[model samples]
Target: MHYALNVYGADINPLAVLISRVRTARKVEFAIGAIGASVVKRARADRRFGIETTLANRDKWFRLEVLTELSKLRRAIRSCEELWARRFLWVTLAETVRLTSNDRTSTYKLHARPKHEIDGRNVSPIDVFSDLVSRNADSFAFFRKKLRDANAVSHARYRASTDIALVDNRESKKCWADVAPFDLMMTSPPYGDNQTTVTYGQHSYLPLNWIDLADIDPKVDTELLRTTQEIDRRSLGGRDPVSNEEEERLFAASTTLKNFAEALPDTPSDGHIRLVRFYRDFQASLEAMIGQMRQNSYMIWTVGNRNIAGKQVPTDTVLSELMEHAKCSTVTMLTRRIHHKRMPDRNASSATMREEKILLLRKR
Candidate 1:
């Protein structure tokens, strides 16, 4: 909407896709304040006391009181007549769950707080949800005002096409073919597999359990929430045992990758298999994204080098080489210092990088 251009995006994470859709939806109601108040009022009046989620070890992650309060909020949000408003409320509720749950907020993994910490905490889910709703509603109002100032709003709707879907780019099928031949592509692919780099799925697991799956996408399977690590496991390269043919194709396409692999010590402890599998999946995803771009289109990729076995993987160089191999030429590369990007500072498998590389390329 900022540029009044049609936009399309895809992600394998259902929660991510839902948030994207809610934020980019063409028709959005401006009465979030009234809607939020109504939700809170309804939740306060609600007498239902049943727990809503069957997440494994639910009691361990949430106190009994917290679970009951959250269930009331969920039921109230579901009662809203408008789907868009309900989706917006759900996002707010997800944040509230993150704040009120026993899980520590500092880490992506779902580690529960100590018994004393959990017991001493005086958090009220309803209060957190109410505050969040008010704050988020204000933010949305400001955003809408800016869009209106920019003349991007027409008849209370955004003036451009917006499409967001839950799509796994590694799949062979061109799920985004309907909107193919894009003139510009910009993305920040994961630096490495989510398990080692960032446990995004685990971070989302708790909130997802309380959220209505149908609100996210009908195609999203409940099996993804069966375990805290299920979503991460389904992510790129999360599943192990990279095929020899895939390794060969990836290494053949990017000499930098081959050299990096060759440089690793021949030991299971060297993280050789993990590195190869991640890059193989990365290459496949890159190919799928590039295939949808129009000839001569510009592509901007933001990537970061990750460490494996105390060695830095030159992700920028490897990505450039891979793009070149795919008949794309690098236009320029820029380096930016990371200021506030969320990352694990002490991950055992991968050390944090202080900077990121942005590569500009043109499809040939």
Candidate 2:
């Protein structure tokens, strides 16, 4: 069987080179499925690609044959011996979904899914899986090294408190919570909801559909993939757009958001609502995170400015303002250029983004 090698160019980050050197070289091991060319052709005729459903037309981006073969391969992997190895194979399969699709973008949460005129974007399951197997070997090696370097030993497992409003709920020790404050934190929060910005949920949807939840972890929520948009819906701005929500407190919290809302054009009211809902939810999350940090700790906030209604949303500036309200002063801000990303690039708003902002802050 012939397989193509995807070689990365020198344009990649220098850190990637360092990680590659540290990763212990190892042979890529994988379970070879009985899915042959004939099996693939047979599956296409077998009809599982939603040809008759409302989603039938999506075949333009995701060919029926490719989808069926992938589905067949994934479902069969569950019966394979060595549960841990099987789970890893399933993750590799999920990672290859975007690669096998006809869409130009490698990632999803499209803001909106686009229809491609070209019909040759679909890749065979064999090729996609093969490429992923090769990639995973190196990826895992680097991950192990990183974990070793960070000394990521197991810590006490405690489910996050369900209610953000309960900051002083004195029952934390009873629940075996990690009341010990964190020394530092670094996170790249979402630019907005998955539906509009990255479509992370949509990108994850196909892979989750193929991966059995029980194999990953018993605690894993199967409900997250119940709907194609379920994860995004559960995320900020995942609900139906409505302008009547009492978000005055949200507007009052950040002058940047307030000013942006006022300047929004009288079109796509849903967009307006999406922005408000996302920021409001984000504010709640920020407050929750702040509560977990030690005094005078360092935090690094990586964010991007997504365009909405043909205007650049001042994310870094707004974060600075919002953090001020949270009592964290911004130490400095830096801009990182995005060279080549797989995210959707067609949307005038939130797509075709070139740079992301990093905000270094200190908790007072």
lDDT of each: 0.87, 0.58
The local lDDT score (0 to 100) that residue 349 gets in candidate 2 is 76
Tens digits of per-residue lDDT for model 1, 243-286: 88988889898888899888987665737888988888888889
Which regions in candidate 1 have their CA more than 4 angstroms from the true location?
266-270
The best candidate in terms of lDDT: 1
- C-alpha positional error of residue 61 in candidate 2 after TM-score superposition, expressed in Å: 7.2
TM-score, one value per model: 0.96, 0.70
- For model 1, state the Cα shift of residue 196 in Å: 1.8
RMSD of each: 1.5, 9.9
**Runs off by more than 4 Å, candidate 2:** 1-68, 80-83, 102-122, 142-176, 240-246
Worst 10 residues of 1 by lDDT: 170-179
Score candidate 2 by lDDT: 0.58
